[model samples]
Target chain A: MSLFHWLRKKLLFLTRANLFIAIGFMLLLAGWQVLSFYTHEILLASPAQAACALWGIIGTSYFNENFLITLWRLFFGIVSGGLIGFVLGTAAGLNEDIKNILEPFRWIMLSIPPVVVVVLAMLWFGMGSKMVAFITSVLVAPIVYVNTVKGIEMVDEKLVEMARLYKFGFVMRIKDVYTPAIIGPLGAAMVLITCMGARVVILAELMGANDGIGYALGVTRSNLDVPQLFAWVLVTLGIVSVFEFILLRPVEKHFIRWKL
Target chain B: MSPVISFENVVKEYGGRKVISGLSFQIHSREVVGLLGQSGMGKTTILKIIAGLEMPSDGDIKVIAERVGYVFQEPRLLPWRTALENVMLPMIALGMNKKQAGEKANHFLGEMELSEFTHYYPSQLSGGMMQRVSLARAFATEPEVLLLDEPFSALDLQMKDAILSMIEERLLVQPMTVLYVSHSQEEVMRISNRIFMMSSGSKLDELPIQHCRAFRAGCKKAFLKWTKQIGSN
Candidate 1:
């Protein structure tokens, strides 16, 4: 495509919502720049210093290796955990007995700290990607499970009765009724899980694992490279944003187009 | 002609309170039966039992229809689907392909005079429009048996009259066995071939009247007198 055509196409995707988000980001960056000036360089990195550090990190082979590792672990962790949660949650949502049986497990999972889980995971899986992924999945599953149960329970009874009267088959009931009813809640839960997943993965990697962004952050922290530490944090935030905005948001928007 | 629906001593209880006790009724194929009763008098319960949404605590209920359609009091359209899509759902459930379902949905929506509003969501539509969508959805399925549980009760008189006329027109084109439960005597009189009054005891008493497709002054007078008799009882 010509430059003008490409530019027009891109501009069509931009709306007032994007403009407001851009302005809000600019204001936040300005605030951070002001705050950095008030503190020592070693204590707080300026946005410029962090940006320079991030640019430098991106050029290195270490960045590619560690970032890929973290991304892969995050992908596997979320998929496995989310699937298990969805299946169990659907069962629990349908049957009171299953819900009751799973209640204590959900409680324990929610109540237990990530630190404790990381420590336990290390003992079980050893110092590797497995440990980090396991910890991430454990933290992610309960959130998804709880939201799924709530979503299913809140499906309109009248609609269900209508479905029954119409003799909707099992697959049709799931596709037309249960899936749509749960998508709203599940979408919100997914956004929450992505951010939470990123944080827990890093924490787990930092505590137990030998590679990934968390390990890189740990290395920077030990060397007192504040700008590099901030750079790693930026990269983590970028990944989470990509997962949420690029991946989840489009899927959510497609499913809930009627709302728009 | 064999009855399409037969209820034999059907009894239902909710938490030890007998809502329907030994209710018996039979509805033949293509019969449009209007059910009039006071609130909380098992009118809805009877429809539920017939629809198999609620199982009777005791008795044998036989519904021989291959397909049943229900127009609930509330417009229970899936909020995420458009008007046309909502009408297509039951057809899709019956294993119709998307193209055929879509065509049928469009035809039904057109019949309801909602051809222009086919893409509107339930939340975007007005209350009367939503109810019309519900009616279209029920009709699109080509049900052998249709149960209308006060489908127009939430509508205003003006909208109610328009929809009742649409229903009467649809039934003329495509006749189905319908058990219509409504509180409005005028609405019941306009649509029903026979009117049955249900009492608190879950017993049905058939009221004798010359069946009319449209509400007339003479039938209105007779309906008022029968309603007054019911009230007095």
Candidate 2:
């Protein structure tokens, strides 16, 4: 691999595709914003004004407060849900007796909608971080659990036997065999849960919380602050994409190079 | 030489269809034993039983070796790891420190002439290279007994020749005992010191290499004289 070839590989790997898409996105928003001009700009903010408001929102203390609240809830919910899902999923996947016992419950979790879980859970526990986290964790758990169970069930039995012959201990078995095996579906499942978890937290905030991006959006809406609402929406989108690109994508690549 | 592994009256079945019935063998040290049978005759299952992946229905199995290394019919290398990492898998499992495991893996990969491809993943390697990595992984364990399940059935002629000889050199140069399973009589003759013929339902006829080395004995008249006699009866 020469320097030129290396550079070319890097260039191809990280393309201008996202930036161009963003440009096209700005064009679409510009069109939508300009259309608002003819309608007296009642509900929609112009793209330029919205961009200015995006900067304003980021520069203000309100953004920091709301971002922190949403971030904390999502993180807590996902970690808790992922751990529980992993444990229960592995047990169900590996043990026939355990699967028999847990099959009905796991199926029930998979079938129930997150919105329903949130509404009922909010009524039961009240609208707060704990309630939201609990609901989001339930939402995340089934996806993780189902994906994990599906992953383990598809684990190449021949490799398991190979591991046995080598006498692979618990740690080595996970690192050497199971990690790569689980990472594919788990990667997809994590992304799904993260998206759902974030949305659930925002909904939890909108329902009753005093602070969060969702609450800020609600405040801006009632005040007819269209620009600020758009800014808040952009912030949420930024957090979602940034975490996706920065955190999950590379981790997925590291664990599942075959995917690349 | 004392017997280090034994299978007595082993019975194997799948959904009431008996595959190996009353199978028995005593494998001693310092021998490369070939298990030969036609497809679906359960040669692989016998190796699977000895490797402890599957248990016999009603039999006694005694293995005195500290570790048993196996090369599955499939490559079965961890797709995430390099060929070197895959080869050092057993050592890592046995809790050897990273330095020792890596050094051992590097040396064996070098011995197998796979130094250039040490960092390659299973997908990156050719079918032959993948099989060699599997072989290297099995041998790098330093186990007393190696169980191979048709390790070279997938390779082309050139790759097969190179890999089989590479494996032969590694095993022959060390105190490695192998219970190799293969469907090809040619493969059996090239590597095995003893051969076991398995027919339907666990009946075995063990033949020494000197007696059954068809080409070497120039029994061109009856290439598999020993195996045929039993099958015909």
Which has the greatest TM-score? Answer: 1
Q: What local lDDT does model 2 show for residue B92?
A: 81
DockQ in order: 0.70, 0.70
The candidate that achieves the highest DockQ relative to the unseen native structure = 2
Q: What stretches of model 1 exceed 4 Å from their correct place?
A: A1-31, B210-219
TM-score of chain A of 2: 0.85
Cα lDDT for residue B215, candidate 1 = 43
| Candidate 1 per-residue lDDT over residues B157-193, each given as its tens digit | 9999999899989999999999999998778877888
Cα lDDT tens digits, model 1, A1-260, are 97556655789965667667877999999999999999999999999999999999896899998899999999888888887888888888878999999999999999998899998999999998999889888888998999999998999998888888878898888788988889999999899989999999998889887899999999999999999999999999999999999999999999988888
Clashing pairs in 1: none
- Interface RMSD (Å), each candidate? 1.1, 1.4
Candidate 2, B41: how far from true, in Å?
A: 0.9
Task: Give each model a TM-score.
Answer: 0.91, 0.90
